[model samples]
Target: MNISYQLTQGQIGMLISMPHNGQLIPDDIASTMTEKAKLVPDTDWYMDKLYDFAQAMGIATIIPKYSRYVIDLNRDISGVNLYPGANSTELCPTTAFDLSPLYLDGKSPNEAEIQRRIKNYWQPYHQAIADTLADMRQQYERVVLLDAHSILSHVPRFFAGKLPDFNFGNADGQSCSQALIDKVSALDLSPYSSVVNGRFKGGYITRAYGQPEQGIHAIQLELSQYTYMDEPSDQYNQQKAEQVKVKLQQFVTCLADFANAKS
Candidate 1:
């Protein structure tokens, strides 16, 4: 069993990744965290639930079992900042987005511990992604990858004011073909705001594996949690969730069709 994550094969040559959806914290690690950190507020709460429709769409999906506090799989294993100039989080973040300490005083994971987390958590997730794509690529010439994520609407540490409801990133058009991007960019972004290649222009997973020239295209979508969640409380809003999922199903279906046509 791949204890690190859950993966399912797709019939449509597409993969959806939710790296931060994990909320499990090993007791050994939780013992070192602050009271607030133990709650795992930084998690992409309920993302697996939010994107559950992908499974019905025959889109392969993968979600990690451990919290990002264990290791940020979206981040580079070397701990390089995906956005160098901006305030960014690390592979094993010692502090929360609000600059609050996640660990107790001097109880943070050190360099050695960070490396251990990478080996234990990060490596497995990426290897599964690479391995699955390798197997799928043999059958399908071009496979589309959708990296899904969500965040609080107003994270001052990352952006000012409220964030766009839908933030699409394709590593600034290098990760996917123009045809794929145009299709996603042309979505009916009414009522909700959206921007392409804005504050978040994709992360390690999109940049590292997205080789459009090599017949692998990737796109990262960052949604505002307000779109489907009641924040702080994480109450399930079936009405809000259904509305968003309808829109997502349309987008993913278009993406899959576009990738095949381009290939």
Candidate 2:
């Protein structure tokens, strides 16, 4: 119902998407949620802050204004599981990352409510992605989407042990080009761990939008929260963020160079 998101146009063919960066829950929606849900602890906290370099680098970006609790923008419109046979949340999630109930008894959104959210929240966000990518494809020989996110180092519901600092997912090489993958994998991410096509093999955004044949590449970077923030306090650590930003800058530069390369 409200302004769904913010869009920043860029001089280059790179678009950084932070679908889970938001933490705001409408007062009306907040009233129906449990105390833990109101906290919005599952958010991809401070993603915009961490990726501030994108602006100067002439990269475009789209940021959501509502929490994923309102509706997961990165998910499919049909509510299909992004990861089947695995414990996962819903498009209109009823539970948090810890598998705890988000809504109070009898407050969970039913089918009708879910439809409304899809129409209002989900549709608009995805439309922006589609339109922006389409425009990029028109102006450039290649365009790359960096779907950015951050999570706590450990979430038992999804994985057993601590997550790597940088988790790159390209839907098992179906999403982006092998060249871009090689570029990122070659980065010197010292003092941090990284994996490709591992636990996170890209989400809906990467899977749906990435079309290497069409010259539009998409990849997801699921960062470990401990790399840039104080997990216990949910606060930004400037020193820590600066260090991670260096690597992120390298990744972006590679993506930009890839996009600008002659086809």
Please write out the lDDT profile of model 2 over residues 1-263, one tens digit for every residue. 33989999999898999999988888888999999999898999999998898999899999999999999988887878888899988999999988889999999998998999899888888899999999999999999999999899989999988999999999999999998899899989888999999889999999999999999999999999999998856889999999999988888898899998997
lDDT of all the models against the reference? 0.86, 0.92
Score candidate 1 by TM-score against the native. 0.97
The reply for model 2, stretches above 4 Å from the true place, is: none
Model 2, position 220: C-alpha lDDT score: 98
Question: TM-scores for all candidates?
Answer: 0.97, 0.98
Ten contiguous residues with the weakest lDDT in model 2: 1-10
* Alpha carbon lDDT at 87, candidate 2: 92
Residues 1-263, candidate 1, lDDT per residue (tens digit)?
A: 67989998778778999999999899999999999888888788778887777777778999999988888999998778899899998889888988899999989898999989888899989999998777777878889888989888888999998989889999889999898899888888676789999998999999998988888899999988888888746666788888887777778888888656643
Q: For model 1, what is the alpha-carbon lDDT of residue 29?
A: 97
